[model samples]
Target: MRPSRGLLLFLLANLLLIGLLLHSVFTLLTLLFEDCSNDAIPAIDIPAPDALEEINKLPQYIPKIIHQTWANESIPEKWQKAQKSCRDLHEDYEYMLWTNEKARNFIAKEYDWFLETYDNYPYPIMRADAIRYFILNHYGGIYIDLDDGCERRLDPLLSYHAWLRKTTPSGISNDAMGSVPNHPFFKSVLDSLQKYNRNWQIPYVTVMYNTGPLFLSVIWKEYLPTVKSEETRVRILMPAEYNDHPWSFFGVYKGSSWHRNDAKTIFWMGQHWLLVTVVVFAFCASLYVCGFYAYRRVHLRDSNYSAHASPFSSWSWPWSKNGYKPIKHEV
Candidate 1:
């Protein structure tokens, strides 16, 4: 006997639902596995001489100063204080501070491609953050954030070919960095900028991923394998060595007022992703099975009924007030 039109339609609808459920399951799995937090690079521990001893043995070739600020003549008092702190520590160093216009011109003249990207960035602060990497790559000197005051002399940090400071919460920070000119790591960072430049909707997330600590951290991870020896390796100043207090090299002022994080900042799958995947998969599978069983029950009951029987002769509506009634059919 040929299948009824109702049966065929029911089967087609179930198949479509099943297909959609499968697609959703696969997509969820893909997203869970591909999460950025799952791929966080492990921190590297670079062997170092004693901090006090290292300060005396600075590289002669490395430039003394190269800091950047978008501010022109009217520098903020807090930032100006930070700049002065650095100057007080080392007055002999040639401090070449780049203003917004000068930094723009420099990138346009040397790295024109990067300049284009800098100009077109959705956020202005990203341009400020990005230019420091290119400047450090070209000039090879200390690049400190305007809010980071010198707690102690930074002479010790200059001994390394390239270095970045580890930050709180997690990963390395870009607030204060030092590098030798044309260092392979900084070069890699500059080259990878265009590739990692992604907008993640949230202002804080977008900034972090594109030009802030997260970007530097990811690039640093990629650059680690290329180190053939300790001399050429980039150093990471752990939080203990880079933060506020006399023991640390820099004091961090509460300068960031723009970026704010709320409940949405938390990425659910980022932590315990494997567990989440298992739970989600099981839940979806259960739903699929339940739906399939319901579809089958309705269709199969309709198909197996005797042809002469009325629609409600054998089957009763579970929720009906007059239940289980057998209707008489005309022969």
Candidate 2:
């Protein structure tokens, strides 16, 4: 005999419930392993002498400037104006506005091994983001985004061996990063690029995870515990200190299409992967239980029919017997 629809649904629901439970367990195990692995690695600390007293000491650091655009000629008028702001503030700094070709050439000459992955990057903005960390590692200097305008001389920021700016919602921003040549933190960032390089299928996610602010944030977190002293630690300039007012050190321009959040971004940003898994498991389990209950009810009905209809049946309903009639009246 063919199985009823309820039975089939019950089997399918059971399978779904089992899958969800397994997935939840796997996710928990993976998270645990990763936490333990991170703890196992030894922290690296670099010493910086007199770093606290050397505020506003720009001359001692590299006076080079670096920024990237699609190309020199393709730069928008507003961005060009922003670039001029940096130039006007620090005339002595060797400002270099790298175009695609120039950036490729520089990377090819200095970091040849990174070229394959760099060229294979699915997005231009990803390439733009990745090169800055490498540039700072090879030739220490200030790297700023084209959309960011300079409100004052960046000399004060150059005091530290390295610095990162804080961003909203948590974590550091990569838009404005400064470092001395071969800073250990920057080196860690470069070294981690290939390992963290992932294609998340979404453009924004891929860029952010591989080479954007998220990438930098992860490396910075790992680098933090390694700092044995205040001097060696990377100084973080809070949003208030960096750009609280219009005349703040970095005047940010909002008109940029390169980085925008989407539904996928929001979904990942929520970061409730484990919670979501648990909820799904619960829902599936409930569905399976309901289906099983329905199946069992149908099964019992069928079994009763089979038992009564059989030639050798020993049981029967009391009301189904021949000449069985109620003699009593109303109540």
Candidate 3:
């Protein structure tokens, strides 16, 4: 049996919704989970706790410069200890604290071309997020957040041409990064800073998708596919070698001082993402159903109009006001 018109309409509406949902999911996965399977810095290559001493004496690829940033010269009481931990652990390494004035001055002096973009960032945190990339590209060194303290010597990480720490679920974090000066990956990141620079309106989202970790992750994902040689490849620093293990290089402390109220909503949604997804799907389905019914109502109302009173009603013989009549003479 043939399906009714209403049934066909329902099927079509559902098909459209399904296609839309699939497209959204594909785009999200493409951005958030790209390159998760490979490119991770393997454990075997990392210097174990027992080998930290031997590795420190060996020559390293990255410069012995540790970069950290803040609003001014005076570090806050809360993060001062964490900041000191890195210095105490790496006594021989040079430490550069990028204050607000210093950062803007450096940008203006060395990279005047980016001064406009650097100045126009909607959030101060965006500037902080951006300068780290530029600093890494200009000078080969490890950039770590003030909140992240060094637990072990970072000489092991210096061996990689360029490296970024991986975060939970998917994607990489910019909290800690190391690279040789002018590495292709860092150069790509430098080139991409302005392109990804757009005000998303929301404080948290604008910072993240524009100049924060998400931006870095997206650039890393895109940059990997174009890399033809091992030297140009950006290595992934997995959690185990980062902060998950006792032998991990760094320890995380409380951070996110720049987060606004919107960040809480975002964090809540992340915690209850499955429920949010289900509700969103349900709402879309409900809209489709309601729209289909409204269409059906309009169609039926038009078709069931009074034929005798309406001049533009369906074509019919004069004798048949109801839109049909028998032809007696020609039978």
lDDT of candidate model 3 versus the reference: 0.82
Q: Candidate 3: deviation at residue 317, Å?
A: 32
Which one wins on lDDT?
3
Error of 1 at 151 (Å): 1.4
> Which 10-residue window of candidate 1 scores lowest in summed lDDT?
38-47
Candidate lDDT scores, in order, read 0.70, 0.68, 0.82
Q: For all the candidates, what are their Cα RMSDs to the real structure?
A: 8.5, 10.9, 7.6
Which prediction has more favorable lDDT, 1 or 2? Answer: 1
Q: If scored against the real structure, what TM-score would every candidate get?
A: 0.66, 0.64, 0.79
C-alpha lDDT of residue 92 in model 2: 81
Clashing pairs in 1: none
- Residue-level lDDT of model 3, residues 199-271, one tens digit each, is 7788898998888887887788778679888778788888888885888988888998999899999888767
Show model 1 residue runs off by greater than 4 Å. 1-54, 57-61, 260-331
List, residue by residue over 1-331, the lDDT tens digit for candidate 2: 3555655776886788688877744533333223222212111121122333443333455445654455554778778788788888778887777778888998899999999999999888888888788777777889888888887666666656778876654466788888888888998898999997878888777887789886787677767678876456687766655665543578877644675566455557447656766788688778766866575555555555452332213433356665222222234
Pitting candidate 1 against candidate 3, the one with the higher lDDT is: 3
CA displacement after TM-score superposition, residue 120 of candidate 2 (Å): 0.3
